[model samples]
Target: MVRRVVVVGIVLAVVLTPLMGWAQSKAVLPPIMPLRDIKPGMRGIGRTVIQGQKIEEFDIEIMGILQGGGDVIPVRHLILFRASGPVTDRSGGTAAGMSGSPLFINGKLIGALSAGYLWQPGKRELALGTPIEDMLTVLDLPNGTAQTPWPRTFAASEPFHIGRRAITRVVVTDTLAQAQRVDEAGLPGMTAFIPATFPVMVSGLSPRAMGFLRQALGAAQPLLQYDQEGATFVASPITGGSSVGILQVRGDVSYGGMCTVTLRVGDRLLICGHPWDQMGEVEYALTTSDIVTVVRTLQEPFKEGNLGDLIGKIDQDRGPAIRGVIGRMPRMLAVRVAVTDLDAGTRIEKGVQVVRRRDLAKTFAAAMALTAVDRARGQILGGGTASVKITLRAKGLPRVISRENVFYNSRDVALASLLDLPDALNFLLYNDLAPLDPVDMNIEISVTGKRQTAAIAETTVERREVAPGERLRVHMTLRPFQEQTVPSRVIEISIPRDFPRGPAVLVVGSAGRQVSLESAPEQGLAQLLQQEPQPSPAATLDGAIQLFEDYGKNTDILLQLIPFGLPPEGSEFVKFDVFAGEVVRTDWVVQGEIQIPILIR
Candidate 1:
């Protein structure tokens, strides 16, 4: 009987879920006043923030309804209105951050404050409201609906030059492209549709860190004048007119935008007077925030915000507004950075919950990790040797890559020490074998105040000629950083028995960097054809990791030697053009290209 009841319950749940969802989807929308019914003589009240976290009411009078393409609504209609009452008396004009302020007439919802003109002190404020009916259209969309022109990889993983290059071009939002979009909305000296800048609730950020973020994000940079934060962090809650943060990174380096809430219906929400990236299906952390204050200027007024607790994700960003679902937390990448100082016997470990993304992981990781190191050292500066080991834990990947690297930064030790892991991870994150789902990122960085590096200052060959099966010795003068030079040591190379009687040249340089190799060429055209662009399993995770290892790390020695009988062709490189592990990894970081001539007999 119990089994039957369980089976029947499952059957009913499966049968009734679609019915309930359909009924809900077809439900009547909230009371709304059509754009046609709105008149020039209509008077209404709107809600927004002018001072603090409070959502105060502002009086507005509809001046006219604009139907031209130049208007905010362009084709349909926009209720053009002017500000009045206490809001005007205090603020002097409609502010930029007041975009999402809801407007109502006769106790019925009309629209949200969407567009604004340049504000002048002691002048009546003019703005346009987006119809509420347009916002409700999102609620009826299919669950899997995606925003048009999806986000795709455009650039390689380089600072400010990665992701969706076909669109953004140079930066995440290229200055030229972004300026064009911003201009299309409205031109200065005329009433144009303006999207309010969402407040970014930031904390524990240094000027250097801020500069990095602005560089990465491009023209969408935050207006620092409205920032409200300090060394410590505070949690913001969900309230209309209050700020909500879309966090990209949290901890040493924090980045995110703070948007205002317009309305809430059950678990569904409407926020930000404008769109946030317009990424159709996205999972980004949404946190609550408080308006620290308002920064007023002739250009425009903006609201400063202090971030608070993470709420949920604002999923759908459309034309007029962004919709969010509360209580659904977005997935984040887990990171742990441990910085240890050898001399001081001190170590600090900071962890961050970063937005998991291939385009952003490397940059954000570097920023956050550097911040942690700087803060731990009281912002001191110096060059030092660093050893970095990284472990990447990912889902669906067959192997976890554990890569170790060493660097001696003669300039800034703290920053240089933090470089290898993030740089290496860039290739891993942007690998073509689908997107890597990184569950955890762990980095162990050990730093020493002293330099632990060496280079070959000079080289001398003991003998110019040698018989086959004989060992040839080459002496190298090793120079240590800021230390006494070590006496020359001999490196032996064996002449193979099969070598022809001829002369050969051996050129050695710092390995891994500018490294080239040679192999026997195909004797036949058919064999040579097979060497061309063949498909690579390098498209897989293991293959991608191997690719990263080969070109990413700066370690070992690369020696290009012309064996006795081989011809010195146009291009010395025997390019196999396949994913192969480093064929020549040296224990020491070798430098300089020393050429030595040898005669094989």
Candidate 2:
């Protein structure tokens, strides 16, 4: 039969008074028992203070215990209850400010006070605690080794930029809103709350361009109101209340499109996630007469308001609510490029563009094609005039290239020109799309080539549902000079699900020969036809641990912990660690935390 669990509350407070006198006075008393020795009904005295007055009188009792263990240490549990104590202010009992109050059972450190009930009332209240055993799990001491010390404190580091470009800011907006009644009368009310509204500002570009954008915005009369099933309203959404309003507005700008502008709300300022590449000061103003819809009722009576009233109170002082001077125009495309050569080349280098746009596939293809041409042939070619033929090679589709058919003269030519295929394919796939329908396409290119001849190639197209964190592994076997079973190196490409599909690097090896190739979708499998491969780091748990240890020496905080429960029978426990760095001067921190999976054989 299962036993019922009893839940009780405890109150705790921390005193920061000097320990010298108390230490001496308590020397003769029996040494406080360690947390492990405490049991239910055990009584103890807690010393604390209230409002600057030193008080050493409070009563505590052990209520229950919790237990958990692992390979390294056994965790301890000590649940305590407050029998009597006037230790803190009435409103401050277990307040938010007291998150980590140390608890002692018979003078033994047992757990940290974590939570309490606000409705319990008076000096005798209940509180919950995280047992010392939980802390042991955090410290990776499942077996309870005395040598391992728990980290006294932990702090989150500021996010860092590790890739080629910094992720300055990512703004997400809600596209739909639904209304619910907060009161019985069903009258129109605030559905959403405006945290604060500052002038929407634009800067960085030439005065002519800025003026043109302003004019376009003013003349277009775009609606920025909250819409609920075609109904409109005019009020900021109330906190925790049900109403409909604009969800959010997100904007970000980076290199290749960096321009500075300052948005001000009185003395406040708005800037990018990170410092701008270029800095300057400029005045900002709200683009006037912007339409904003607000949904006031679930029924027929919806209201509409202008941007000004939606953001600012009519009776309050209103200047630019946002302030500061740094940032560029939002980008429409994430990776932009201009290419000069569409035909062929071994090494390619070109400029890249990052911008915002409605169609990412179209923008990405255009930029990639341009960059490929510029790097290969050294001149920008007209992509619009290129008559590109795309074939979907599948079980039932027509073949673009086949093993028995040679489409080009030489394999070198095939591989060199294959760098621009993704762009062509993307362009072909998304040339025309309906407003409500999403264009989706997936294709794989297989190329067979010889130095003297472009032997054969094929494109396989199919619809694939790709979700985040999904892994796609491409297996390639290289056969040079028609020799079967040549010794070839295998390189795996790990495309992070979050990363956009664009220019990517791949390594292939055959007969001890390695080659590096510039790859995009349009170039297809041709660019990889005859190239050698290069060495790549192993993507394994042990490999990752070694890499972190080598490069993470400078990290400020390092935590190694074993998970709860021992490895299954015949299996080894997996070790995990979390590393973090903090720069005190800038209040910046970088965290690298991952769980390493290990198999015990």
Candidate 3:
């Protein structure tokens, strides 16, 4: 009886599997119009939200098709659309946030509302459309390549082209998101045509912090305004013509664009009528968003919205559009931050859910950590002593990359103490090898009211010369920060047994790396990050350990004894011009430089 009942239950479960209910989620792929079939003087209408979730239609007439593009993209085809009717009167012309709005002619689909001219002396009616054929090609494309075929191009006289492409700023840790800019030329005649890379609504960042973000990111990353409405960000669904975000950040700082969802086939979705970053075959986080309202400006109009839960991965970032997949969360690097305030006797611990991206992983993570520390302390860190311990773990590494550094600055110790981790991550992310397989990261920061900086007041040496294998002692006087206490220490070392019978120099100075200076090459730093050669994403974690070790610490006290002359003919010192001590790394900001001459016999 039990065997018969169990088999009957199994059969019932199998039979009911196909009957499970999924709420009505329609994929509106009306109908497609091929570029070859489109001609001038054709009439149509399109749908998009000028404000809120209300879908409205505007009249459109095809002026003609364009026939010229660039070198890499040989496809010379884009449909020109002229606007009229009530939609034209309300919006004046094409909007920056209306890139992927679908157009229908004769009750069928044509393509997305992509771009428009930057300068407009009168009514806005001219715009460009990326053929439905190309936008559809984004559905199932591969890395570094697109499947869109070169359609036949027709000759059209003086057809208005899309605006110049300007890089968009994107970050997904806690604070900001920015889309692309079409007005790259910045001509004097144009009012302010920011018709690309829709607004990146940011939350939780003050104006000052937003300014700091600009400083930290520099020019390669675009800047966007701060939005407070995204504080209640949650996830929804990815459907056709719905607002979607290629989320880079969540939590307190919502940084990602409010873009239009172009198409959906099965579990696959297409979005961002233009490229988000155009880093093909990417695995970026995708989430649903709700349009709040459109802020109209003389320069440009934008849509501000709140991002919803992360539910998918953006599989491709190509020219025509960004494509994504639902039902799977993207792989992310885990970040944990602990801030201890001694004065208040309070400790705050926070965890950041950072997206795992090649160009964004390190910078975004570091910004998140910095924001966490700043928030825990109730303000930006300034004029205080801080001890930071950073632990880095990866998949294949035998041990964690542990770094402990101290900071002493009159302005802000926050940046100095926590800089190494970010720089190291940057090196790892931008390595010529593979992506870094980061397991988890912990940054333990302790703060105190006392200042921890001193300058070398005086230096005294035991002797001007020394014999081989002799021990030498050096005394130094130090001046503390605005305080009466003057503390000093003695550093000692022994001359090499086979030292050359010649003069030498002893150089003593501040130890750790320079905080104001950039540790990376300037030329490459200004440009966009290129794709790395990777066997697997985590291929270079081990070598990155060496890079982290070499960047030096800010709180370190660096001391060195250099033999000024060439070593006696056969000594190992011949390979080097100077003998730097084994302890070259430090966390202390160097305050003084002193050179003393000595003789080695």
Scored by lDDT, model 3 comes in at: 0.56
lDDT of 3 at 424: 51
How do the residues 289-330 of candidate 1 rate in per-residue lDDT, one tens digit apiece? 555455555555555445555556666776557787677777
Candidate 1 TM-score, true structure as reference: 0.71
RMSD list, candidates in order: 13.5, 27.7, 11.0
lDDT of 2 at 361: 34
lDDT of each: 0.54, 0.25, 0.56
Please provide, for model 3 over 1-601, each residue's C-alpha lDDT reduced to its tens digit, 9 standing for 90 to 100.
0000001000000000001111226654657778878887899987665554456788999877665444554645566778778865676566556677777788777877766544455555666666778777778676677434233222343433334423121111111211122134343322121224443444455444465555556655555655444244323333445555565655555456556666667667766556655667667766655555554556444454555556677778776777877766777777777888776677877665566674455555555556666666677646677888888777655677777777665666555556555455654454545444777778898877677676666777888877877866787766666755455567676666765668777766665654451232222222322224323223355544653654345544445566675432222321222353423333234477677888776
Runs of candidate 3 exceeding 4 Å displacement:
1-30, 70-73, 121-123, 143-195, 219-222, 230-238, 346-351, 377-381, 427-435, 454-459, 466-503, 516-551, 563-591
Q: Write the per-residue lDDT of candidate 2 for residues 347-422, one digit (tens) a residue.
A: 4332222221223233333333333433344332212112122222222222222111112212132233323333
Give the candidate number with the greatest lDDT.
3
